[model samples]
Target: MRNHTSVTSFILLGLTDVPQLQILIFIFLLITYMLSVTRNLSIVILTLVDFHLKTAMYFFLQNFSYLEISFTSACIPRLLYSISTGDRTITYNACICQLFFTYVFGITEFFLLAAMSFVQYVAICKPLHYMTIMNFRVCKRPIFCCWMTTLLIMLPPHSLGLDLEYCASNAIDHFVCDANPMLKISCSDTWLIDQMIIISAVISFLITLLCVVLSYMYIIRKILKLPSAQQRTRAFSTCSSHIIVDSITYGRCIFVYIKPSAKDEMGINKGVTVLTTCISPMLNPFIYTLRNKQVKQAFNDLVKRFKLLSKN
Candidate 1:
């Protein structure tokens, strides 16, 4: 791959060119990145230590939190460093690594969210069989499949990316090493790989989205059929957090990647990418924990345990 390309390093243009604006962007990204990592890490720790959280729902939540941490960490820290140091140049290998990890984690998240939707469906629509249906062994299988399937979907395009020749330019137009921006700067015939990326992204997006939609359809139907209003509300409440997260997750990605003319919309993509990579991750923990009674109780218990340990 290195031998084929004349460019040894690519300069990331970053979010802005103005030095003063860069400072503001850097501070914003820094604060959000710190908060995102801390909140997501707390979720991971809470799920692991809390006995009450030992269920299939929380198992998926733990993995989702991990993905949030990883997806944001991949993009934001690098941009923050570039903003702080005035060094926007990233090595060829480093750029590829960033692109690879970001997609792998981000795409796996779509599948995981779909799996979470199915878990919700079973818990609501099949209350008697919920535990038996989503047992520990059953829970682990979807998570594993999500990772493996994402790899299978991502590897071919990424492998083809290695053969791309970049003699024309070395400056990627976005803040991160995204595929579209990288393709725009390459000298190779990117039409085939570009189409492939779009096809894979659409296929992934639609299939997972269909799973979520279908699961929610069944859940809503079950809730509507409940005898009491209180029973319906209680059942619906359990799904609210997942629904909100799913909306934001899918909405952002669809705006960026699922459009017919995404490549030509670089200006809009940058802003959406910021929201996707930084703002969304920071908000997700609050969305789940604040809305979720079980998670909140687990968090409180964990905090109490810490205080008791400190006093001793």
Candidate 2:
């Protein structure tokens, strides 16, 4: 078995080999990437500039928006370059860096979502104590811990990949430097790493999902107890957007990462990856804004201010 140190670069076999299809995919992904960045950045800016959005909820939303931007950026730019230039060769170190950052951002999103769910739980189930529970200090701690813990947890697995021997073929079958695809190319024994990945994925998903479910369960129970139907509707509406986003994010992630045979289905894996990495980030701003009257109003106010500045 050849040491990975000798393998300077690996070729990426992207989504399709057809030249025409590559161009089409390039255009489509370019548009998707741009829209994702724009929408996410808009949410961040809106949350920052709007006085009405200075609450803990919007603070969490802003962090989430920034996370989405970083997450998609890590995956899409390399993908775009591969598709547009038809040059899919990535150096060994570069691939490792890509994998590391991707997992870092991906895991960070999990914790961020959990934090957001907790914020929603407090807001709905304990409205009286929502502010006290999710004040600036309390809210900032989770975000800080989420990023720090993700960095620490992800480093070991990524370092393990760096230590792998790559005597086998250096062609990655997917568009991104996904864990399983990278492992498939390694000549070293990957059973331990594979098990580690599976265990980690399961644990992370279950723990965060349990938190979200518990939060939502309490939220639903509280909403059901409301005497007025209109009050119940109003309470439910506030969380509907978060629930939708969480469903899409977690559904795709679980299908791709948490399954026993996840690595065996490259086609479905790529499709699901695209949904989570590209499509979901773009959809988040629209879902949050459309469902939220306050965000919509803030967005409109920002647009008018922009127009006034342009006229001047």
Candidate 3:
């Protein structure tokens, strides 16, 4: 019989084994990380400094951008280090910490997105009552709830992982210390953990997605009823960017976590995870700023301020 012992550290196999490809991957990820940081930080700063962006929509967007920065930071730096140094090993405790924070940020994003959808619904459907309904006090509640609820919801699965025995091979076939990869390396039966993950993912995904869908449905109904065709176009334009972001974020996430197991498709899983962790953060700020005229004006205003300060 094979002796079983707790793993002290894990070896991350990373995206590719080829040395040449690793360099290319490192360059790609470094550029992506820098861009993600710059774009998200710009959004947060712009939202704070620009009076025009103080509405509930920008408030939610700023929080979401901050979350994106944090979420990408939690994984990308470590992945970059591993790629650069050819050191794929991570301490077990570090892996657990990474896993915990990743889920917290990821789950919080769903709630935030739903909250943003609610803001859109109010802005479009009840324009007259928008300010009254989505005041600062009201906006703060959902943000707080998103953070608290996700923390509580994620604690169980993270704790469950801490209890599992990892006697099997410690080589993880992905760049990040995600739950599925961690579970795959555990010698102990993870049927319970697997079920827990599925249940949590399903409930969270469905509830948030339902909220977004319902919000958009009501929005569409309201838009269609508007007498002016131009008004309908404007309403649809406001939502199109959000819909794009939602599709990218939820589509990849559902593909990864909603399944019974992702262990079998390590290659595809890694690609999708790269999109979620690296690409999503980079894309979100651009989507919001470039697609929305208000944000573009805000950004341009900020630039002019900087230029004026420099001249002074």
Model 2 poorest 10 in a row by lDDT: 255-264
What lDDT score goes with residue 116 in model 2? 90
lDDT string, candidate 1, 84-117, tens digits: 9899999999999999999999999999999999
TM-score for every candidate vs. truth?
0.96, 0.95, 0.96
Compared with the true structure, the alpha-carbon lDDT of candidate 1 equals: 0.91
Q: Output the lDDT of residue 196, model 3.
A: 84
Q: For each candidate, what is the lDDT?
A: 0.91, 0.86, 0.89
User: Which 10 consecutive residues of model 3 have the lowest summed lDDT?
Assistant: 256-265
lDDT of 3 by residue, 1-312 (tens): 666987889998889889899899999999999999999999999999999999999999999999999999999999999988888999988988888888899999999999999999999999999999999999999999999988777877778878888775888878999887778778878998898887888767889999999999999999999999999999899988998898888899778655545455777788888998999999989988776888899889999999999999
Regions of candidate 1 where Cα sits further than 4 Å from its true position: 1-5, 257-264
| Model 2 lDDT tens row, 1-312 | 344546888898888888888888888888988999999999899989999999998999999899899989998999898777678999888888888888888888888889899899889888899878888888899999999978777766777877788775889998888888888878888988887787777756788888988989999999999999999999999999999988988888777655457455898888888887888999988998887989889999999999999999
- Residue pairs with colliding backbones in model 3 are none
Q: In model 3, which runs have C-alpha deviations exceeding 4 angstroms?
A: 257-264
